[model samples]
Target: MWGREVHSHRVLITIRTKFMARDVHINSYLIVATCGGKAKREVSLEELRDHIHQYYIPLGRQFMVLFPEGGFLHKRREISQRFAEKNNLPKLEYVSLPRAGAMKVIMEEVGPHRDQAGTSKSDDRKDNNFNQNNVKILDTKSGDNIEWILDVTIAYPERVPLHLADVVCGFRPACTTHIHYRLYPSAEVPSDPEAMTTWLYDRFIEKDKMLEEFYRTGQFPPKGNTPLVTRPVRQDNVRYFILHLFFIASTFIQYKLWCAMWSCIW
Candidate 1:
């Protein structure tokens, strides 16, 4: 579980990802708000894809997203990064996009061969060879090779292609001998967490202002809704209840004053 503060606004978002039966779980919610509270709106997949393409993909980071088919998340980041490297396209961020709904997961390559049988091999490098960082010789009882893998879940909008999985797997051979640590979902791990957070914050809270500024500068209009923002707003019923209480109190006070006056006159 992780909490990230989006930039340009006062919204803190909590993120979590878990694995169950080969499926990854994602949960996210805002910790703080602005005004009128955030609504329970559907996360838009198209907008999410556009965000990754326009923002994250150019940064040269590895990311993944699940598909509607419900299979393994694809390794799209690795492929994109590899392509960028081959063609020398400055710096590109590698991210996955699903075909539908939101998703949350950060792909990281873990090292060290603990073996699926729960056998720890801290000294495997001095003892044996062949990829110890990625499960050596399969012990069979530790569940499938996929079970040993874990990921960090971040917020996402939908389904992505499966080919991205292969790309992520392609990067595992580079860790030092006998290293045990692996990458899990975390904003702290790749790029600038602060930058990402601030970008998201500005996207949500400053929609109208950003649009006007862009228009003034003659910039292209944003493709999706300008501000995908959320805020906590007070309810009208609560205000009405307060007024009703005041009215009742006023009536009671008037009745008491009348009783006092009648007693004095009597």
Candidate 2:
């Protein structure tokens, strides 16, 4: 099973079982499904996890296939590893298959039909650009932001659907609360890799043993996104780089002036 997406479905071929039943048991299973938003409809990663555990685990089936990109699947890897460590079950592994290889099989099995499929329209792109551009970030200790503005008219001449773009863009739901915010400028919109590191550190790591506790309980604490006040970090780096270059140019001018004065005296 790849996911609920009509196009990316799969059938289970075989069940491989490995049981280490100590005081605690570490059962495993593979899950597959499509990845998309809430309103579009279909099976969710959490639903798949529950389904696999309910149907297969008790029946002596372990090891589930999961879409590499699925959201809930992420917590599984972390939780399983923690369970294995605490109870000393065994190393847990999560495998990811290429989209074509695994996703194709799942879609073939379930045969789901998409309501609105295919490339997005120009108007859709324009709308996304407009929304992101006007998006306001509020409630931070520091005023730092990654500007996502665009010339909407030029960028999206006409309306278009954005299903494909959403997947490729790595957009995910985040905790948003309205609070006072300040603005910081950036040369380019900060990328996800950079942002995630900051988020993991400020939001996850900074918490007192949150990673360990979350792993043990299989629960994520409700931490407001206030901790992610590091947009200025990226912006500061960019600003510093620009300032350093300016300083170098100023130093060069001073050297030239000094040389000219010395040359005239000589």
Separate clash counts for every candidate: 34, 34
lDDT of 2 at 153: 8
How many clashing residue pairs are found in candidate 2? 34
**Could you give candidate 1's per-residue lDDT for residues 1-266 as a string of tens digits?**
01222222111122121111123232231011111112321223323323333333232222233332222223344553565467553222212221112222111111112231232222344235433445333221322111221222222212222234533454433221110112332323223334433333323223334324433553324336654233334447688779889989999999999999999999
TM-score of every prediction relative to native: 0.16, 0.17
What's the true lDDT of residue 1 in model 2? 17
TM-score of 2: 0.17
How many angstroms is residue 185 displaced in model 2 relative to the true structure, after the best TM-score fit? 41
Root-mean-square deviation (CA) per prediction: 24.1, 26.5
Worst 10 residues of 1 by lDDT: 29-38
Q: Local error of candidate 1 at 215, Å?
A: 12
